[model samples]
Target: MTRTALVVRGGWDGHQPIEATDLFLPFLRDSGFEVTIEDSPEVYRDAERLAATDLILQSVTMSEISAEALTGLRAAVAAGTGLAGWHGGIADSYRNSSDYLQLVGGQFATHPSTHPDARHGEASDNFLDYTVEITDLGRTHEITRDIADFTLHTEQYWVLHDDLIDVLATTTHPVQPYHPWHRPIVSPAVWTRLWGEGRIFVATPGHSPEVLQDDNVRTIVERGLLWAARSE
Candidate 1:
């Protein structure tokens, strides 16, 4: 049977939800997903719509979801509908919504930058380099299996996460000018977890379509979506 995959894209344009989600469309289609795209999270209120979904790719950034909408979403995931997202879309989204944070297994606190860019004169200039080391768990996980370590020049997500999450890939952050904290913070760059029978996948790398277009991000996210769909 053809699986149903919902792609909801909207929120802060800085994350370019439309463009970023667009990069994953062909993959979803090629993988046998009957794709549905929505520009708002309000679509979650349609109980019948969500009940028919197999997987959901939420690309909204810091947008607030209504209590009713969030209730529908949380119920669907817990009842075996898969959820997947990246960056601020899934991680940094709805800061005030503690339930959403718990559901995703993390909250984006900040993206610490170690770079000293006196030229730009702002902290945003500090988006520096980072390496994502695929973990042993990743080597065995269906989504990232056979993939090697990768690097990205984007925001290194410093998230407040649940320890029970199955960490797939990680990046070590060092103390720097912008990040005055002493100690190398080990952060999860990719992870997967179970919410009831549902699977959740998150990759904190897509800052733009260019970033999502990276060969590694593209391949991993594609497989990740397939894995979330339980298509294998």
Candidate 2:
């Protein structure tokens, strides 16, 4: 069967939604999907289109979606359309809509600066070396199995999430003398969620095109997209 995949991408040019999502176009096609691309979340309002979609790959970071559109999106997913995304594109999007946040399972809070002296607005402030430790569940989950702990120098998202999500991997923010945090803070680096009959996948590491190119990150994301699609 030819599964339909929809790519909704735009917002916050910093994340390079176009380029980042472009990286996976070939993979989606190779995976037997008939891919469609949209630059805004407005497409979510199309119930007929969404009903035919098997998966949704969203890359709009910090963007807004109308209440009606959000309703459509939630309904489609609940009816078995899969939703998957990486980094700020998914976690940081639609901040105004708590409904959207609830559907996604998490939200991006902050990426602490690498040093206290670093200026807040500088791009380099949030870039730091961090390790993603796979959870026991991750070792066995089809989306993350065979992946070992990996390190990266990029924006390490401190996400605000709930227990509803199944955490697959985690990254810890160590307490530094220069920072105010009293103890190490751990956050989910990769996770999945079940909503109705749908599957949702999220990864917090793809800050740039380079990060998406990492073998481990690339492999997990590719497999995740496939795993999230509506099952036969």
Candidate 3:
């Protein structure tokens, strides 16, 4: 039987939600999924439809979510529908919904200032070169198995998370001259969690389509989608 995969996109254009999601479409089809695409979160309200889905790949970033939509999504996840996404699409969405925040396990905080002279409220020139170190746990995990640690030059996310989830990969940030920090900080670059019987997969590298196109990032994301759907 063919599995159903839903791709919900569209939000801040800066994240390139549509383009980022498009990069993975061919792969999802090639993997034998019957894909559905939606441009907004309203689809989450169709609980019956959501219940029938095998996976949800969302890319909504920094958007307001309605209580109804949020409830439908959280319910679907608890009912065993898989959830997966990368970067801001999944983790950085719903800025004020605590329920959504709890389900995602993290929120986008701030990255090191990329601009040498960035001022408050202005975009930071904070794209840093970083290495993602795959953990021993990830070496054998379905989503990250067989992939070696990789390096990326993009907006490395700094997020707030809990200890309930399993971290698959991590990155360490050395104190930058621009930020007021005296010590290095370690953050999860990839992680997975379980909500009821559902599987949740998240990767923090997809700040753009180019980041997702990186061989390592794409491979893991592809596998992550399948893994979340219980297809692997």
List pairs with backbone clashes in candidate 1: none
Residue lDDT tens for model 2, 1-232? 8999999999999999999999999999999999999999999999999999999999999978999999999999999999999999999999999999999898999998876677687788889999999999999999999999999999999999999999999999999887889999999999999999999999999999999999999998998999899997
Q: Write down the lDDT of every candidate, Cα atoms only.
A: 0.85, 0.95, 0.88
Give the distance in Å from residue 83's predicted Cα in candidate 3 to where it truly belongs. Answer: 0.6
Off by over 4 Å in 3: 115-124, 230-232
lDDT of 1 at 18: 88
Best by lDDT: 2
Tens digit of per-residue lDDT, candidate 1, span 25-65: 88888878899999998899998999899999999999889
Give the alpha carbon lDDT tens digit for every residue of 1-232 in model 3: 8889999998899899989999998998898888999999989999999998999999999888889999999999988999999999998998999999999887788776565654455433667788999999999998888899889888888888999789999888888676787999888889999998788999999988888999999998998898888543
Clash counts for the predictions, in order: 0, 0, 3
Which is superior by TM-score, 1 or 2?
Answer: 2
> How much is 177 displaced in model 3, in angstroms?
3.2
TM-score of each model, paired residue for residue: 0.94, 0.98, 0.94
After best superposition, candidate 3 residue 86: deviation in angstroms? 0.4
